[model samples]
Target: MAVSTPPRRASRAPTEPGSARPPGRGRGLLARATLLLAVPAVVVLVVFFVVPALRLLWLSVTTPEPGLGNYTAILTDEVSLTVVLRTLGMAAIVTVVCLLVAYPYAYLMTIVSGRWRAVLLAVVLIPFWTSLMARTFAWVVLLQDNGLVNTVLGAVGIGPLRMLGTTAGVTVAMAQVMLPFVVLPVYTTMRGIDRKLVDAALSLGARPVAAFRQVYLPLSFPGVAAGATLVMVLSLGFYVTPSLVGSPQQSMLAQFISVQVNQLVNFGAAGALAVALLVVTLVLLGGVALLTRTRGTRSSAGAGVAGGLV
Candidate 1:
């Protein structure tokens, strides 16, 4: 005869009145930790960049009796205005030249493969590895009167061109220097593109040129815009190449600012010029951003509608 044990009673824990669980505690901790890590970089920027920028603004307004005199002088001075215009024009030309040169080369890189692609990329990047001063000096040697370029031209019965100490020489050097800036962005964008889309278009009876113009060109605009903006902005503040290769007539804003500070001993004027350059750069960048944003919004909307239809 076996005795049957009673069923074991279930144990239950007591619940508190307000014990709701907090969600994503781990994620919250991670965010807090990231912010903590970012503090050092923030401090460095404030100390180095923010402080100096603020000081420059202060000097621009207050250095010479502090009544916007410096700014007014900049506006009214014909020489100052001319320098600003020349800077703007030169920057625009350099940007355009860089885009034209870089786009074709970048596209070629996308189509090629293996060792050939590597060789082409290295050629594009060679300028960056070379010293800027050395390159400028080399250009000077080649651009001077009775130099290699002129010799070649004479052999062809073309010209003994006066390139050194002229606008043309400066423009050529600036374009060469800015080429890599344009190429890297465009090449990165081109490499990420889906070539299969072009292939599909081709299979659907679209001509090769038409397919490229319709599909690939639109996709590459972002890179083009990026490269153009970079080249334009950098060209605005260029000093050495223009100084060494260009004439007094082709003086850029930076060179003017340098003359004010170094030769004329005019801090107030220099500060004002610096501020003006900063304002112009910001305005152009803002315009570019607005235009790109508008285009992006429209493209996104069109894509959404197309997807819905399909």
Candidate 2:
């Protein structure tokens, strides 16, 4: 008893290579907490977005004898076809214009410093904080026959030209509002590009423009793609600015949907039109997503190859 040995230590069980450990209690609690925190947002989204969208979808098929007559009518009707085409055409124009305008401005932002850069960014973002109605009306004032634009033109010996009540007017207004969306994405991409790469190209006897085209432009393309997709989609469904500054003939998909619902009281037609616009939007976004995914895959593969070579 006096010389009793120390109690034998318990041997720990060994875990096999594929054996799973018990889930951490803290991790489980954290996950539950995160789920609890997200419940409110989920509820709000379901109540507002999901519910209304589903209602619209249901109304599209069920209204006017629960048939696809409205869709058939949309396809066959000349007026509907014209509206859709005009919407698409204007969206394309606006997207292109925004891209052209944003690229240079974004490049400027990447080059500028301190206060000037801040000011440029502020200018890009200012429109978002302002009222949409105010901006639309401001465009109305500028584009109206005798507004500021015409006044400036008159001072230069050019007579007043009609800008308001035209497709061009709508495009201009849409571009003004959508410019920030394009600029920000491009600027973000430009900022992330390694300046040394361009410098290296310059040092290696590459011309500035050539280096930019071969090196900088490729890196910035994803941003351009993103911005163009955003601007195009927004322009497709634009209502306030287009309606305020554009003629009846220049009405977009949103205005058409509104007219069908408000003036014509054709719920079936309206719902079908809405559904058509939604489908087109989704299709476009899906195509953009596929393009982006392909670009990312190629980029990753290229990176892996370069890494392996290194």
Please state every model's RMSD to the true fold in angstroms: 19.5, 17.3
- lDDT for each residue of candidate 1 in 1-310, tens digit (9 for 90 to 100): 0111110000111121112222324567676675566466566666865576567667767877786777877767888878877888999988988988999999999999778889988998897789888888888998988999899999999788899988889999989888888898788777877899899989999899999898888877777777887788788888878888998777988888888878998777777787777667656777677766777676552222212211
Q: What is the lDDT of residue 157 in candidate 2?
A: 95
Q: Estimate each model's TM-score.
A: 0.82, 0.84
TM-score of 1: 0.82
lDDT of 2 by residue, 198-255 (tens): 9999999999999999888887877787788778767877788888999877787788
RMSD of 2: 17.3
| Candidate 2 backbone collisions, by pair | none
**lDDT of every predicted structure (CA atoms):** 0.74, 0.74
Which lDDT value does model 2 have at 42? Answer: 62
